[model samples]
Target: MLKTLPADSRPREKLLARGAAALSDTELLALLLRTGTRERGVLQMADEVLQRFGGIAGLLHTEPTALKAVSGLGGTAKRAELLAVMELARRAAAQQLKEREVFSSPDAVKRFLQLHLAHKAHEVFCVLFLDAQNRLVEMRELFHGTLTQTSVYPREVVKQALALHAASVVLAHNHPSGTVQPSRADEALTQTLKSALALIDVRVLDHVIVAPGDALSMAEKGLL
Candidate 1:
C-alpha cells in the first residue's frame, strides 16, 4: 500500500521532494492515477497500464474508448485528463512553431512532426506551406493511410500550395514501423511532388521522414 511505503518512495512525496524530472515514467503515471483499487497498488496499476498500452508513445496514440476499459484508471475522467494533457502538449509545440521562423528552426519543425505523426496508427502525409521568405503559412495533414503506405497525390499537393499562395513547401510523413529510412516509393513520391510544384514556381524545401525518435531529411541526404 502507498500509505505504508517509505515516504521517499511514494509518488507524490518523491515528486515534491525530488521534482517531476527525477521520477520514472511509471512513477509519474502513478501520480496521475492517484489511487489504486482494492486488488492492486497504484504503482502496479500504472505498470500494467503502461505494459498494456506499449508505453508512453502508445499511450499518446490511445483512443478514449479504449482507455475507458482500463480498470482503476478512473474511467472517463482519467481518459479526459490524459487527452487534455496530450492536446496541451501538442498546442504548445504548435505555438512554438507559430512564433518562430520555421525554416530557421528545423529542429522545432521536426519535433512538431514527430509529435504529430510518429505515434499515429497509420501513415499521414502532411505539408508545411511556406511564404516566399520561407516563413510558415500553415501546416496541414492532407492524407491518411494504412500501416505501410499512403497515397500522395502530387496534383492535390500542388493545388493546395497554389491555393495557399505558398512559394515553398516541406513534406513530412511518418513510418509507423519506426524506420526513418526513405524507401524507393518515398523517394519517387518526393521527386514527383517536386516536379509538380515547380510548374507553379513553388520549391520543395525538404521531405522529412519521421519515426519515433528519429527523423531523416531528404535535402540533407542530397536526395532533394
Candidate 2:
C-alpha cells in the first residue's frame, strides 16, 4: 500500500524529505511497524493501533502482554521494538529530571510522571525522590490498587524516603477515571504522608495526579 503512494508522500520518504515532525502520527507509527497484516494496510493498521490505545501517550504506558494482543504487533520483533522505544522515552525523561532541579521545568516533571503512570487500567501510587538540590534521585511505584483506589502506607513511604536519603519527594498517583482533580481521600493521604515524612525531615514537594494524556500539580493549585 505504501508503494502505491507517491515516493514523496510515503512515510519514509516524507520523513527523509521534510523531517519526522512533518509526518502525521499514523505515518510515524507506520514507519515503525514496517509492514501490515494480510487484511490491512500498514497506515490503516497504525491508525487502528493508535485509536485502540487512545493515541501515543496511552501507547507509552502499554505493557508487553497487552502489545501481544494487537494483531499488528503479533510478531515478537515488532512488540519488542515498540516496548524498547517506550522505555527509551521514559529513561530520557528521567535523565532530564536527574540532571536538573525538577521544578525548573514544571512541565518536564508532569511529562515524566505521565510517561510512568498514565493510561493504566487501575491506580498506581508512586514517589519521585529528590536530592537536597531538588534533582531527581529515583522514582518508585510504591502501591498498586483497584480501579478506584489504592491503599498507600505513610510508614512505608517514610521508610523508603529514609532509605533513599531523599531530602524531598513528589507524590504522584493515577486515576483510572481519567480525572486529574484530586479527591478528598487523595488530599487526606497527602497530609498524612506529609506529617509522617516531616518527622524524618523529608519534605513533600508536590502531589501530582495523572490520567491518560493529562496531569495535575497540587502545588500549583495551592493544595500542597
Candidate 3:
C-alpha cells in the first residue's frame, strides 16, 4: 500500500518534506510502527491501533500487557519501541515541570499528571511537591483505592510535605471511571489537605483530576 502511494505522500517522505505537523495521526503512528502484519498495511494497522486505544492520549497510557493483546504489537521490537516512546514523552514532561514553575504552564501540569495517573485502574492520590520557587521537587503517590477524606490522611500528607520541605503542592488523582468532574468527596478531601498543609506554611496550588484522555484543574475552576 505504501509503495502505491505517491513518494511525497508516504509517511516518511511527507514528514521530511512538510514537517511532522503536516502528517495526520495515522501517518505519524505508522512512522513509529514501521511495518505491518501479513493481513494489514502499516497505515491500516496504525489507524486500527489508534482507534482501539481511543487515539494518542489513550495510546500513551497503554501498558505492555495491553500491547501484547494487540495483533502486530505482539512482536517484542514494536512493543519495546512503543513503550520507549511513551517513557520518553513522560520524562520530557517531567523535565519541563522541573525547569519552570509547575503552574506557569497549566497545560504542562495537566499533561504530566495525566501521564502518571491516567493509566491506573484504581483511584490513586498523588502529590506534586513544589520547592520555594514553585518548581517540581517530586511527585509521590500517597494513597490508592477509593479516595475519600477518610482514606487520604491529611497528617501523612503533612509529614511528606515537611520531609520534602515543599513550599506548596498540587494534589492529583485519577478517576478510573473516566469522569473529570470533582465529586463532593474530592472537594472535601482537598480542603482537608489544604488546612493540614497550612499549619506548616505549605500552600495547595491546585487539585488536578485526570482520566485517560482528560484533565481538570480545581484551581482553574475556582474550586481551590
Candidate 4:
C-alpha cells in the first residue's frame, strides 16, 4: 500500500486530505510522529511500537529509552513521542482523578488518592478540600510520618481548609506495603482527626487508604 500509490498517497497526505479521524491509529500516530527512516514507513514504525510494547495498554507503561531501541525510532522522535504520551496520560489521569468527584463514592475517593498519593514510598497524610459544588479546591499534605507515626495536625488541616474556603475534605494516605486494609493506627487517627476537624465546620468527606493498585474508603465501610 505504501509503494503503489505515489508518495503523495502516503499516510501523511491521506491524513491531511481526509481529516485525522479517518486515519487508522497507526497512521494518526505516524503523522504526529513525522519521520521514521529509509527502511520503514510511518505505518511500519507505528506497527513496531505497537508490536514491541504489546499495543496501547503496554505502550502506556513503556519508557522512552526502551522505545528508542526500535530501529526507526532513534534520536529526538523517541523523546518527543514518549513525552507526548506521558504528558497526555498524566493530564488524563489528573482530570479523571478530580472530575465529577462524588466525594461520597468509595471508588471515587480511591481514584483521587491514586492520582495524588498511591505511588509514594513515604507515608504522606494529605487532605483534599472540596468546594460547595463538591469540586476540588485544594489538596495539602499536613504531615509526613515515619513508618510508624503518620500523625496529622488537625489545626493545620482546618487552617488550610479554611484558608482555601473549602466546604469539606477527604483525607488520604498511601500504604507502601500495597495493602488496602486500614491499620488500627489509621483508624484511630481518622477518628481523632475527624473529631478535631469537625469543630471547624469542615465535613470529613471520607478517609481513603491507597494501595499500589487498590484503595479503601473508611466512610464506605462505616468506619467514619
Candidate 5:
C-alpha cells in the first residue's frame, strides 16, 4: 500500500526533500526501521509500531521485547531503531566532550554524562580525572554493579586520581529505574568518595546521579 502511493509520498523521500524536521515521529523512525514483513513496507510498519509504543520517547524507553512484539517490527527493526537512538545520543555526547573542559564545573559533567549514562539499566560508576587547567584528562569506569551496590573503593579511586595528578574530579553513576532522587546509599557513597579524594587534594566537584530523562546533583541538593 505504501509503495503503491507516489514515490514522493514515501517517508524517506519526503524527509530528503523537506529535511528531517518535517517528518512525523513514525516517519523518522521509518527511515531507521527500514524494512518489514512481505505485505507492508517499512514506513507503514514503523507507523504501526510507533502507535503501539505510544510515541518517540515512549519507544525509546520501551523494552526490546515490547518493541519486538509489534507485528512488523521484529529483531531487525527493534535493534536498528535502538542502535540508532543510542548512536545519536553518543554523537551528542561526543560533541560536548570535545568542546568542554571536564573540571570547569559540575554542571558540565552532568550535562555530558546525562546523555549517555542516564538511561543505563545497571549501575555504572564513571570517573573523570581533570588536569590543572581543567582540560580533559581521562575517564575510567571503576566498576559496574547491581542495583544496591557498586564495588567502587575510594582508595583505588583516589590512587588513580593522584596518579593522574588531577586537579579535580566528578563522580557519575546511573539509576536504572529512572528516578533521579539520590538513594541513602548514593549519599553515603558520595561522602566516602569525597572524603577519600580530599586527602589527595583532588576536589570532588560533584557527584552526579543520573536516571532516564532526569538527574540529581549532590552539590545542588546540599548532599555535598
Candidate 6:
C-alpha cells in the first residue's frame, strides 16, 4: 500500500519536497527504516516503534541490546543504526557547545545538558569548565549515583578546575524521578562547591537540575 501511494506523498519524497522539519516523527522514521515487513507498512512500523518506546527520547535512551526485543526493529543492524543516529546527535550537540560562548547562549548549554542527562535512569553529577570569558573548556561526568542521590566531591571538582585552568564552572545533575526541584542537599552542595572553587579564584555560575522534561537553574533561584 505504501508503494502504491503517490511519490510526492511518500516519506522520502515528501521530505525532499517540504524539508525535514515538515515531516512527522513517523514519516522521518519511515525514511530511516526504509522498508516494512510483509505484514506491515513502514509508516505503520514507525508508529509501532514510537508507541512501544514512548517517544523519540525514550527510543534514544533505550539500550541497543534492549531494542532487539522490539517487534519490528529486531535485527542487530537496525539497533546499530539507531545507536549511530543517537551518537551523531550527541556529537552534533557537543560540537555546538564547543562553538558557542557558554552562558551567553543559555539554551545551547541546556540542550547539551538535556542530551547528556535527561532520560537517564540513574543520577549523574556533571561539570562544565569555562575560561575567564565563559567559553567552554570542557565537560565531565564526575560522579554517578543511584536513582535518588549522587556523591559529589568538592575537592575533586576543584582539582579538575585547576587542571583545566578554568576560571569558572557550571554544575549540573539529573533527577531520575523527573522533578527539577533541588533538595536541601543540592543547595548545600552548591554552596560547598562555590566556596571550594572560590579558593582558587574560580566562580560557580549555576547548578542546573535536569528532570526528564526540563531543567531548573539554582543560581536563577538564588540557591547558588
TM-score of each: 0.83, 0.94, 0.93, 0.63, 0.76, 0.92
Per-candidate alpha-carbon RMSD to the true structure: 2.7, 1.5, 1.9, 5.5, 3.6, 1.8
Model 5, global lDDT: 0.74
Residue pairs with clashing backbones, model 5: none
Across 1-224, the per-residue lDDT of candidate 5 in tens digits comes to 55666867777778789888888887788777666678877777777777775566546545555656677666674686676786686566555654676545556666667666765567889987877766657777788998766788888898889888888887888888778888888888888988888898888877888876567888888888
Model 3 residue 66 CA deviation in Å = 1.8
Which portions of model 3 show Cα errors greater than 4 Å?
Answer: 146-150
Model 1 TM-score is 0.83
Which candidate leads the pack in TM-score? 2
lDDT for position 180 in model 5: 80
**Clashes (N, CA, C under 3 Å) per candidate:** 0, 0, 0, 0, 0, 0
Ranking by TM-score: 2, 3, 6, 1, 5, 4
How well is each residue in 17-41 modelled by candidate 3, as lDDT tens digits? 9999999999999999999999999
Location of the lowest summed lDDT over 10 successive residues in candidate 1: 57-66
**Candidate 2 to truth, TM:** 0.94
Worst 10 residues of 5 by lDDT: 57-66
C-alpha lDDT values of all predictions: 0.85, 0.93, 0.91, 0.72, 0.74, 0.85
Which sections of candidate 6 miss by over 4 Å?
A: none
lDDT, ranked from best to worst = 2, 3, 1, 6, 5, 4
As a TM-score, model 3 comes out at 0.93
In model 5, which regions exceed 4 Å deviation?
Answer: 6-9, 38-41, 47-85, 102-111, 133-135
Task: Indicate the residue-level lDDT of 41 in model 3.
Answer: 96
In model 2, the number of clashes is: 0
Please write out the lDDT profile of model 4 over residues 1-224, one tens digit for every residue. Answer: 46566765577778777777777767766766666678777677887787776665455545557766777766775567666876576566546545666544556556556655655666889888888777777677888976545767778887898899988888888887768788888888888878887887778878888765578888878898
For residue 57, model 6's alpha carbon misses the true position, in angstroms, by 3.8
Model 1 residue 141 distance off true place after TM-score fit, in angstroms: 1.4
Tens digits of lDDT, candidate 2, 1-224: 89999998799999999999999999999999999999999999999999998888878877678889998687789998888899999999999999999999999999999988885788999999999999999999999999997999998999999999999999999998988999999999999999999999999999999988889999999997
